[model samples]
Target: MKIAQICPRYFPDIGGVETHVKEISERLVKAGHDVEVITTDPTGKLNRRETINGVKVIRFRSFAPGNAYYFAPQIYFYLKMHSFDVIHAHSYHALPALFAALGKSERRLVFTPHYHRSGHTAFRNLLHKPYRLFGKVIFSRADSVICVSEYEKRLVEADFRVAGKTVKIPNGINLAEFKHLRALQKDEGIEGKTGKEKTLLYVGRLEEYKGVQYIIQSMPELQEFRLKVVGKGPYEAELRSMAKSLGVEGRVEWLKDLSRRELLKCYAGADIFLMLSSHEAYGITVAEALAAGTPCVVAKGSALEEFVDGTRCLGVDEPIKKEEIIKLINKLKDMKQNSRFTTESLTIFDWDYITEEIENIYNN
Candidate 1:
């Protein structure tokens, strides 16, 4: 089968959606399917065409401001010209999906919105109201509307009225890679720190809606624990200044450009992981933390809450109360001491299984 995996960005630009597209595309290729990723490159520096791990990747120049809208009209022209058995559009937040849908090809159309329901900032959120008019095209044209979480599925159904076409195929992870990478970084002396008791981990883009500030504010009382933030975004400077003003600068470690092995080492070395994003279609990092046998505390109301079963992970409501969050963090710490972390129930997220499910959709 020849398939087109279309999205706003791809590998080298890390995020939940980027990772999802790359994982499924590569797996599809290994299954003897011919896969190509069509995406935008706002900076215009990346190659217009390239191949990574047997999957063809074609990038087009885009007009991206605050790196948000990703206005790339050439995408429509590209899609209209290409031929594929299926064209899978991704990320409702950007315009690439809209262009893909507008192409209105004869092949099957599949859409994975990875919808956040709204935007991360006031301006972006406001734009969503108008964007909804265009959003309908992506959903209405697709043969299948794939959602990564029930949280996302509910919103898609309620807003788009595509309940009949919508399907849930939650994001998947490499269950073994998390465990295998646990010992790689430290053994090679790439990251020299040890004795990480009471360490806290936060991994994702440092966006305002991510609720990372809430964690930074709690640092004074969480004096015993040091935070290791692992990702980059527009909010880094602001977060750093806040840390400095709060006198928690010494306790916060900002890291990015890390290899997969080093990142898993951070996950395995920490006592607890935190993903406080206001909205997420799904939380892949939280899944990775659990896969590494690390306890996690995630924000409620997103798909993240689905991972909280009161043992390996917990959920904290927004308005992120210091006492409430701290108590839960301590609770997870105690659970770790009691040997409560387990992966027996996490096989459902295995990438192999996830690829099978998606392949079923493409074939049908």
Candidate 2:
């Protein structure tokens, strides 16, 4: 089968959608399928056409200033010219996905909206109303629509009335990678840290909707823990300012663009992982944390709630209060020594399992 994956951005961009496309595409290639990715070179620096891990990646020159909602007219022309067995489009809100939907393709189209009705700010939320009308048309064109979570599936059905075609298939984690890391940690006799000054980790884009600010606000109270933020984004300066204002600057460390091995080390060393995002279609990082044997504190009512069991995770209300966060941290501290933090039940999110499910979807 020849599969064309349409997305706004690809490899080295460091986003959930980008990671999803890379993982599934590489696995599809390994399974003897001809896979090609159609994306935009947001920086205009990456090779326009290249093959990575047996999958061909074609990046169009984008006119947009930043990576968000990239505008690439060439994508439409390419889609019209190319032929494939499957046209798998990601991120419903992205322009490339819209072009793929609008393109005249005879292939079976699969859409993974990665849909969130609103953005981190008020203006984006207001725009979502009109976007819903456009979104309906996109989903309506697809042979099948994939949602990463039950929460997301409900939103698609209720907001866009596309439930009949929508199916739940979650974002996955590289379980073998983390298992190897755990083995290395044990062999090296490297336990995270022994006493006080627990390592608290937050890995993802530094964005307003990600709720990194609330974690910074709660830092002054968490004297025994040191916060290490991984990943870079526009909101870093603002978060740094908040930490400074709160007088917790010394206790917080900002890390950006760590290699996969370094990231797994961070997850392995973490006493607790924090994912307090205001919204999440599916928290892939949460799964990664679980696979790394790190306990997580995620937002209540978000898609992450589905991934947590009481033994390994604690869910707090959105706009997380400092009091509750502190309370949860104390609970985690008390249990850290005894908690197993195993990934035994997270096999469902293994990339191999997820890829097989998607293959079945494509074959269907």
Best by lDDT: 1
lDDT digits (tens) for residues 1-364 of candidate 2: 9999999988878888989999999999999999999999867799999999999999998865433667787888998888888999999766788788888467788999887667656766776778777677788899899999988899888887877788999998887898698676766655455545688999999888888887888888888788999989888999999999999999899998798877888888888899999788998888888888788898887687887677688889865787888888778777766664444666447888889999999999
> Can you tell me which runs of candidate 1 are displaced by over 4 Å?
181-197, 338-344
Tell me the lDDT of candidate 1: 0.87
Each candidate: what lDDT?
0.87, 0.84
lDDT of 1 by residue, 153-234 (tens): 9999999999999999999988778666646644664331245436888999989888788889888888779899999999
Deviation (Å) of 199 in candidate 1: 1.0
Model 2 regions more than 4 Å off: 63-66, 187-191, 338-344
Clash count, candidate 1: 0
Worst window of 10 by summed lDDT in candidate 1: 188-197
Error of 2 at 115 (Å): 1.4
Cα distance off (Å), candidate 1, residue 252: 1.0
Q: How many pairs in model 2 have backbone atoms within 3 A of each other, for residues 3 or more apart or on separate chains, i.e. clashes?
A: 0
TM-score per prediction, in order, is: 0.95, 0.95
Worst 10 residues of 2 by lDDT: 339-348
